[model samples]
Target: MQVNTSNDVKIYNLSAGRSQPAWISERKRRQMERADVNLRRRIQLIQDFEMPEVSQGIKVSPDGQYVMASGAYKPRMRCYDTAEMSMKFERCTDSEIVRFLILSEDYSKMICLQNDRYVEFHAQYGKYYRIRIPRFGRDMVYQPELCHLNLVGASNEVYRLNLEEGKFMESLQSSFATEINSCDINPLHQLLMTGSSNGYVEAWDPRSGKSEGVISCDIPDLISNGSGLSVTKLKFRDALNLAVGTSTGHILLYDIRSPKPYYIKDHNYSLPIKAIEFILEGDLIASMDSKILKLWERETGKPVTSIEPGTDLNDLCIVPDSGLIFMANEAPKILSYFVPSLGPAPKWCAFLDSLTEELEETAESAIYDDYKFLTADELDKLGLSDLIGTNLLRAYMHGFFVDARLYKKAKSIVEPFNYEDYRSHKIKEKLQAEQSESRVKVDKLPKVNTALAKKFLEASTNMDGKAKKKARMVDGNPLEDARFGDLFKNPAFEIDPTTEEYRLINPLVSKIEKRRKAKESHAEEEDVEKGEKEEPTELPDLEENGRRGEQEGSSDSSDDDREWVAERRKVHRTIRDEEYMERQTRRARKLLMVDPNRRGKVTEVETGTVPLISGRGVNKANVKPLGARLDEEEKQRGGAEEVQLAGGNRQMTFSLQSKGYERGREASAKHAMERKSVHRSSRGIGTKIKKPWKGKK
Candidate 1:
């Protein structure tokens, strides 16, 4: 019964007349303009149709091309075209169509229950059949996939009627003891859900004739008369969500996987819901007693809007593809409204229109607070903290900060502060600080020039006086000095491919070869000395050999003494025998072994005699070998070849036939390919002329 009052209130009071102030008139003009802007964007009445009779049910076709309605009192039905807005067909029968009409997918045929006793079917053009039923059907649903019409009877029984055969197949007994009031089928999942009068809802698998699950509505709040509330309507919003409407005006939504409903809502009018449906976008629409239609956003459980058409609505239908709502009532007029799909508006043009009153209230509050400043916390609560300094002032001056100037200013302030770069820089600084703290610093020492020290060491180490004098005489020769100086000046710097390779004089080569020979001679002499040191000695030392022999004799005597003592113990220990000792350990309880022939046997009365035996047996001489006995038993049991022959023969025959078939197919394929190749060769130029030379001649 709750309705949106947006249409009842006015923004400005223009009725203050011509004597009102200028500001009042201006305000009234603005309000009128705003109202004019919003009227075209919202839900609005498009057209209405006058029913020829009292309509009991209204439904739109799946393709949204036709609207069908069945009359309440008379057995009459009519179909209308949605695009053309004209009646396509109409028919009247001997029995009333009742409150339900099911149409085939192609709309070529229709079926309806008549007086809970018979079902009337109508085909294209004009063909009809009335079939009798054993039980009174309270509710019926048609499953297109199975091509069957499922009926729930007053006796809590479910029956399937084949549409093509036009006969009742059989009945499935429900577990519920009370009568079922409503039933629906989920075409996608092929499931049947039935609701009983005692608020028990059970999902049935028609194929198995067994209940899939049962939903208990026995909660204390939803129960009445020491039982559960009556289920007036049961509908599936989708394959997974079920919407159950009760006579108490409570709509409970349950997920098929759980026992409890995830959402519950009350209409508050306490009237039986006539029809419940979910639109293509998942919003719920419910109409009760034809007085009001409620639209709810399924996720929020909040009413989007409520429309009162001033008539008792009996049924509702929505054309999902066209976004149009159709409602039928007791009144002759059938109302239709066109509403756009619900979502965020592409352009919210009515922003100022919605905020005029809110702005006025805030202005009044501001005057009382004397324009006090808002703290940082308060600004954050208002979600304006990002607009800290100049940006906040700009928003106040411009009424709202949507201008390009404000956007650029804010972007300039935020563009330089990238979170990743700041974090990386802080990490680098932390690592450097930690490394500095872990290591100790000391003053650096100056380097010493080693060129003079190197020359002094060389002069002192190579003090061959006679060799130096001869080298000085050789250096006196201009040719020799020039050659020797070039080689010795920088023997390491031999060649630079870019510059040294193009030199005019090559004195460094000969001097370098002489120095190389001298180095080789020195290396050869050092190797000879190492070989002599590595050679083994040819003679042994007498004193060392004498000491080694004395040590070996002393060790051998100690080993001999220990061996004698061990031998003596082995010889004497046999005379001292000791009893074997057993250690006890904890284990599970067990009984000790008992002798089988502990009591003496009686020999007075010869009941049995043994021929010759060393064991306990009455007829020991006649005992047979185990192997011979097992061989005799095997002869009686026989082989398993007979049991396995049937299966093995069939398998071998199948494999042989399959192999032969494959070989035949391959042979045929080879013959076909050979014929094709011969045909192509005969058509070629080489084969076209039987004798090329003869044809030319």
Candidate 2:
């Protein structure tokens, strides 16, 4: 039985009315408010979504991962993945139709039987285990009282199946001469009951496969009514009443301990009753026709409830404790009677009322506490007493009001306030963002040179015609032999160059230069404003030296402190030459082209692609000394400048910007790899049984 304990409501039960708190001081009011706030924060606990199938012959997996339903045209059992929004794993039977489903006691095996009297077994995890139907078979049950797994097959001949071996323990003849139509195992009595097509019932010994009691289900009064004698469905309830629905229309309640019927009721419908069900833990029997399902008491055989089965519905199941009856039909109708007082209260109803009460209180206080407006009749029409809460406000906004002006005015008054509050929040956010941008700008302020303008002017003039001519060498192209041909030039030739041409990195050099100039110009303006006199002793910032000394010297060293500056220059040159020599050797080895090849020698190499001098991978200045210099190579060795990697595949090429690129001959290779698993056969994953991590089997 599915008892829903979580939904038992805690209201006053209509016997007790709300009373005032013992003390109504302002302090007590604060405490109540805190408690109410806490209550609202907790997620409400309730039995939520009902299972989709009001499943008959429901077999839930012992591992609790699946639920199999047996009913409908061809019995269909759906397996499910038991996680949130659990999904169907697979259907049990391949037939696309099933009459009934019986789970073997082991649960590891499931039996799907069509009405032809043959049963098929699908092992829980293995498909190897299956059972063959015995001849002259009736009905079979795997478990009784819906309890443990025990196999029993009975007919004119009865047999107890030994499930472990897919065979029967023994076979025997029953006292009845008819094939069995249905069977029920009474857990309370520990006896297997069999009902035959010829209106006979018998109890069989489970172990020996012998008929223990011989009984007949015929009624003299029903015979007088001239209905054909056939038992439709039978169920043993509580070791007492045997509820049987017949093929005609009569339902008989028989006391299994006696031969006489305890009660009998004939259904009004001429059509045969299809199935019978007993609401577990409740003294009720339900019978269904094609159009309706009827419930009656087992002992009195009097009607308890009736519902239209929506047309075409022929079967149903009463939920364990929910009292909800799910009928199977075109759309699978699930219904619960609206009698809240009968059992667990509807969970949603309580929360709805509580929330609505709070909203109405707020709406009501907004009036009398300020200016009253709502009429009593209008308030009622608005479902203020209905406790609709914010839903009512939502519905009001959704209503089809025809007057455009009225809607516009209402929106202007109400929605605009909410929108304005939101926008003000956004404005504050924008101001915060601007403040962050200003802080970053301030931190990036460059150190200023006091005499930057004078230094710049002097430097510009020093570049006279000769200097200009040298600089002009780079005028048309800063990158001629440099390969770039000229970088950082104005891109007025292209629109949306960023989108069209690929850029590897941001133009940091240009940005840095711009920052330097801006700082210098600003410093000059600051000095002019302060009226500072230019001192003659203000020396030039060693502009003539370029950054050569700056690059090599200790940044803090004064010229006077560098007593061996001349020696250091020689030291730097020697280090550079040593690095150059090492780089050359390494390149020759990597290229595997130590001897001249058809590709030509290093000396004849074009300037655009200077073969890299390897060894220590340093710049041209460092590697020049490592290889034969231009001066020593004219005649003795016959200059060879071209250098390539060992494989002779990689060609060393560089741009003026020193951008390196890896080139490939083709996008598709000459040979493609076959689609085979990457793992070696020894990956060591298997299905071997082992001791579990937590000491679990």
Candidate 3:
């Protein structure tokens, strides 16, 4: 009888109830100093329109309090506030939504697309501004100072409208030859960058109405090497260098001065990549496909971090002020930032950021190598995984994912499960999915089309960039992107005005953890729990094969000839000696494929077909052919289509066959094992020998 025993004696807390690190980047001193920093922000489940399908359009008020949500089947634009689930106005008299819903700089007016491509900029207070532009509406954008709504589409043109007269002021021409996909006006400069279906990225000074430069596909000109890749999005890293995303899931970094782009990033394996955002000052770029949000070092072209932002990410945008980010998904769940007190923000984050310029600059010069993340073993010992989900081990494999924004988001997402004793087995499916370590690395991936990138970025957040008059407003423009002041004072969530209950609270899934008082009580409870006997359900032991599959007594004879025992021993010895004498051309047998001439299948061969073989074995396999077909013996067969040869006697015993001794001896021994049999006597023992199947003639 065998005894079942296990030496396993370790405990792990893979639950949300477990304690997180005090702060990811050593915030002990800072937190201690600012006790009031503990307040967390969350969504309040604002107005949810019955638009169960999808929202094709969205326009938020300048204050971010009122929103206009529309879709293909949706009736008009449903307007409401984030502080309540109640909605008021439905601008029902409208058309299909192809372009975005543009709210005026003051949030008092909105412009929308009609079925026939006519636009109506309706004022929230009184009047409506209408315009008839000749083009398919691809995108609609606006500027405050110009008081003009730029409509981009089949034809590239900017229609200037006078607010007071409600009439066209001037018509400006654009340089695109083909249909324009999308366009954006720079907040700092009047320069506009647009993409087209012909793989062309054209930039223009919208004020001067001239082209800055254009990037054309050089490959499409060649007949044989033509690639049908088209430009998807284009954005400016600066005035000279623009980032372009192509349909091939590649990012081309182009400088207007050079004819060719400097580099291309094809990292997502052509998975229809979604978006890329420079964070922590542009040092890091966050790009997302359907499943993961990957962080890449913009300069080094290496993946720095990643996260599973809960759903299919439709958009990604960074809030440099609070380090908060909004990952717009199909469901539109907002994401928050949780910066480590010590880690650096992205490279571009420094140059492009409004706050933490000092830290961003220092972070640039500082070296970031020696730091290490906590391993699964240590996390288990510290009892942290249980609270965060054992999936954390898998989630964190791409290095620590928290990019300053992660903390705030994670704090909200993880808080509901706090103090709960959840089993790691329950969320296993989700972990295996979103948090698996088998994630392929993206050295450098192309950017998404800037138009799509901007749409997503804008849709994800309420960051409205309107250059207003400098006055008492904080940061000069109160509603634009936040400055350093907001990070310390403003939290993300606004308490719902209606219920006043915690709408952000997640539904409870697991049981609460038991509180312990003394060590004695814990031991007694463990003993009591152990005493409650129950048979564990049967499960297949998959790991058993690794230890037990090896057979101990199997004979090592040739697979075809088990009966010829004597010949097997002699051949094994000869082959072993011959292998050492043979000189190999290269080391390691070239992994799974090998050829003496060092070539792999240049031409594909059909599977399951019987290949023609000669006495030389495979054409490439036979490194040293055994030489010479017996033409004399073949002629003796009377030139038949096929000849049969018998090998019963190699020698009728005559000398002088010049080194034929070995073959003769082998032939003799082969005949002996063919008919060996055994029978048992009175003592009762039985033995029998099997023969190698009749040898080839």
- Whichever of 1 and 3 has more lDDT, that candidate is 1
Q: Relative to the unseen true structure, what is the Cα RMSD of model 3?
A: 30.1
**RMSD per prediction, one decimal?**
40.5, 32.6, 30.1
The residue-by-residue lDDT of candidate 3 on 505-623, one tens digit each, is: 21111111112224447787889988896756887676785445443223322332343444446556655665665535233444225421222211111223344456644554333
> Tens digits of per-residue lDDT for model 2 on 476-561?
22222243212222334222324312221223334445656777789879989778755567677777677867755555344423
Judge candidate 2 against the unseen true structure and give its global Cα lDDT, from 0 to 1.
0.48
Cα lDDT listed for each candidate: 0.58, 0.48, 0.48
How does model 2 score by TM-score? 0.38
Number of the top-ranking candidate, with TM-score as the measure: 1
RMSD, candidate 2, Å: 32.6
**Residue lDDT tens for model 1, 486-550:** 43345453444334232222234434455566776888899998887866577778899999999
Off by over 4 Å in 2: 1-66, 70-76, 80-86, 96-109, 115-117, 123-128, 135-138, 144-155, 224-227, 280-282, 330-697
Candidates 1 and 3 compared: the better one by TM-score is 1
Candidate 3's TM-score:
0.39
Query: Which regions of candidate 3 fall more than 4 Å away from where they truly are?
Result: 1-51, 57-72, 75-93, 101-106, 114-116, 125-130, 156-165, 168-176, 217-227, 267-276, 280-282, 287-294, 306-320, 327-697
